[model samples]
Target: MRADVGRVAEALVEALPQPYGRWSIAVFDDPTPNAFALPGGKIGVHAGMLAVVRTPDQLAAVIAHEIGHVLADHSNERLTQELAVQGGLMLVDLFADEPGIRRLAVVASSRDIDV
Candidate 1:
């Protein structure tokens, strides 16, 4: 499994070069059919995933998908978006006493509109 992951990773790196750090693959003994990739080229695969995947190519596809997420910096993007939303909510709460802003917030929340 390690060799297979290494080969697929090497091919992917050659195909889509990035300034990512060293790639490391870890297999967990969990029964859940899951896998994930973190920033900086860290990948993890659950043992049950092998049972669910029938072919090496399928495994490669899974690994590639996870790698794509890391390459795109999805985690950081999600974090930034969440922080921005939280900050906006905090600002709205802080200014809830102001008449205009409070009315806007009430209308936006009641109608599920983005404000």
Candidate 2:
């Protein structure tokens, strides 16, 4: 099982256009058909997803898209946006006692988590 993971990781790395810093991959035993990539090239691919990807080339496509998300710094941007929204809400809560501000802040807070 570990050997299969290593092979997939190697193939995925080789397919990338350039080296990604500290690249690593893990295969989860979970049956969820999902994969994700984090900053600094860490990735997780569920065994269920391996079953869904019938070919090495297909797997490479999936991994490449996930890596692209990481390379583009989407995760960090999302985090920064979330923090800013939270900070704004805190300020609104502390300084303004208006009902409309509370409602507006609630709406903003709800949408912010989607980032």
> All candidates' lDDT scores?
0.73, 0.76
Local error of candidate 2 at 62, Å? 0.8
Model 2 misplacement above 4 A: 1-5, 15-18, 84-115
Clashing pairs in 2: none
TM-score of candidate 2 versus the correct structure, residues matched by position:
0.63
Candidate achieving the largest TM-score: 1
lDDT of 1: 0.73
Tell me the tens digit of each residue's lDDT in model 1 across 1-115.
Answer: 5457667767776777555777777888898998887778888888888778887789888888888878888767756766665677678777676667756644554422111
lDDT of 2 at 108: 65
- The TM-score between candidate 1 and the true structure equals 0.65
Error of 2 at 29 (Å): 0.7
Q: TM-scores of all models?
A: 0.65, 0.63
